[model samples]
Target: MDIVNALALFANFVAVPATAYGAQLALGALGVTLIFGILRFANFSHGELMSFGAMATILVTWTLQDLGIGIAPFPTALLALPVGILASIAVSLATNRMVFRFYQRRRANPIVFAIVSVGVMFVMAGLIRIIIGPDDQSFADGERFLITAFEFQKATGLKEGIAIKQTQVITVVVALVVVAALFWFLRKTRAGKAMRAFSDEEDLALLSGVNPDRVVQIAWIITATLACIAGTLYGLDKTYKPFIFLQILLPIFAATIVGGIGQPVGAILGGFVIAYSEVMVTYAFKKVITYLSPTDWAPEGLVQLLSTDYKFAVSFIILVAVLLIRPTGIIRGKVI
Candidate 1:
């Protein structure tokens, strides 16, 4: 019974939150990986792209709420997600056409493109701040928890009960669906094959009659979809803040590099790894340890490796370690 309680406590604090967070990170990393693989540049503006999507969704959600509209069991943001995705796609396409097109035509080096993307990141960040302000936006609505701690305790007769949020479950389910669809598209669709071929060998793919412009468009569209979905889901789970997205870019980049930048599966795997590391490092395990211990004595300390405020440092440490130990990443992706 004590062991079970300990497990329940662990699940409540570490597993569930980490799983949801990992799903969000995976989605964001997928977009980063796709851009790197297809566009041959590290898009520093990807985080701002996420912010832009969430901002759009939040605005739509506010409009709907003002009109007395809601989905009850689900967040109204779900209804606004399509609009957010469309907005993100439009911005992505516009940026590509106006800024990146000239560089592409000039055959600019990847580093130059990366630098340009940093500039774009600042521009998009400014735009998002101008539109949404720098305050946290609470757009989440509908059901709050799938199972509250009290409910779980009453049902299971356990001292430690798991509390599962509705958003956590929804985030996981949506991530699975999106990832499956993306993989299928890449594996079974004609355009997906062309994109893959282009990533593998640009000159050869062009010679094989693959339309470069069409491929680039598809890549941007897919990237925008992934980024928008990820941002909205994350905001639903937490609070939406324009500046937070910029900070989140670190973990996303870390996940991308740790998972192998060009490998989708690696990105997903790395997301889970990074998420678990952050949660576990910051979580206080004193209660779980005391429950599992045979004696009644408890540890004086919190038994946390690090404070929650420094959680992002875990990702940074892991990222630096991966770069030093395995530059190609766990799945042996392309070197940065």
Candidate 2:
């Protein structure tokens, strides 16, 4: 029973939360990978795009709530998601037409495009900040816990109890559904094939009668949809803050690079790897250790590898190591 308690404790603090976070990161990384794989540039504005989407969702959720609308057991944000996605798509299209397309037409270098994206990042960031203000906004509604610790303890009769959040389950479920749909679309759809062909060889795809403009439009639209879903889910799971997205960008990039840039499967794998690493490294193991130890013994220290505040540093270290040792990542994906 002590062993069971230990496992329960570990799951409560580390496993469940990490899994949800991993799913969120995977979605964000997929958007980044898609843009890079197709457009051939690192988009520095992706984080701000996420912020904008989440901001839009939050605003719409607030409006819906004021209008006495809700889904109850689920967040109202779900109902507002479509509106947010549309807003994000509009901004993304406008950005492509007004900013990125200019560079594309001029045949700018990838580095130039990356720098331009940074400029766009600042602009989006400022806009989001102006709209949402620089503070954490809580918009989550409906059920908070799928399984509370007390309920779990009563059911299992274990000293340690696991608590699971509804948002965590939703994040994982939605991410799986979205990823499945994306993979299917890529494998079976016409536009997906065109996008893949364009990514592989632009000239060849054009000669094969693929429409570059349509492909580019589709990529941005898909990316915006992904960013909105990921952002809204993340905000629901955690809290919506204008600055958190910027901080999250590092881990998203790390996940993309570690999994192998341009490899969707790699992005998913890398997200979990990075999530588990950050969680396990920072998590205090004293409780689990105490539960597993002999009857009267206990450790004095927290037995944590690092503090929670340094979690992002773990991603950075892993990213650097991967870049130095295996630039192509775990799956030998395209080198950036």
Candidate 3:
């Protein structure tokens, strides 16, 4: 049994997947947080928006592949990102104008808005399934690995090797860039300040000359952009399936709640926390144990807290815990 081997295996199982998954969750959580801040409600439709974005990117990637305009160092989906984001923004704006706008005009309660979002979710889900045929599709292409395990082993002359996938690297880079840009926009720009002011006090913001309708419109567009980027990156790293995005709702909700709804920084942290917890708890640790333990001391059973099938349950448990202990969330987000 070697401690070095055990650490290596643990790093592979817990660290790598956690970082990758954390990025995806962070992206999703950002969208949820933005909507909560500006729209003043929990948008249940966000999961489907992400699905729609991913589906759009997948379709575009397929088209590009057919046209033989493939990316070499990155996935073709990366090239299709701007188009997918634009399409998502357009769809979101249209939905707001046609559906949610009515409710806003009526000055509907937050609960009513939540219910409306649910209806929108269903519609978007159906549309995605119809367009994508309810099947799983891989959108990843070009360089698969940034650093292959064999290459690492040969270079370092170590028994253990590290393999970093190109998609994983790209996902992290893109998320960082997007997040930085978002923060800059929110903190530095006049529209961003107006958005914050609106979130702080809608009536006051209106009195201060901020156009309520315009703020709502901008929020929807920004939320849609975030969803598109998050969804596309997740699809590139994993496979694109309309149903999987639906399943992502729980974790995204958990992250939003844990971080304190409407707090962007908290959302990011919550995303990473939830992602690591899920991956670490569900991941089988047999390989890690075998690498570390002596033959006689190794356990017979797999060292996993729960099966992957119960991942959603894990998120729900966390959500319940947070609600019971601190309903306002870690950052004390707006109760509304």
Top candidate on lDDT is 1
Q: For each candidate, what is the lDDT?
A: 0.93, 0.92, 0.88
> What's the lDDT for candidate 3?
0.88
Global fold similarity of model 3 (TM-score):
0.95
Question: Which regions of candidate 2 are displaced past 4 Å?
Answer: none
Query: Candidate 3, residues 201-233: lDDT per residue as tens digits?
Result: 888999999988898998898899999989988
Count backbone overlaps in model 1. Answer: 0
Q: Tell me the lDDT of model 2 at 116.
A: 95
**Colliding residue pairs in candidate 3:** none
TM-score of each candidate structure, all chains considered together: 0.98, 0.97, 0.95
Error of 2 at 251 (Å): 0.2
The collision pairs in model 1 are none
Q: Please identify which of the two predictions, 1 or 2, would achieve the higher lDDT against the true structure.
A: 1
**Model 2: how far is 271 from its true place, Å?**
1.1
Ranking by TM-score: 1, 2, 3
Instruction: Name the candidate that leads on TM-score.
Output: 1
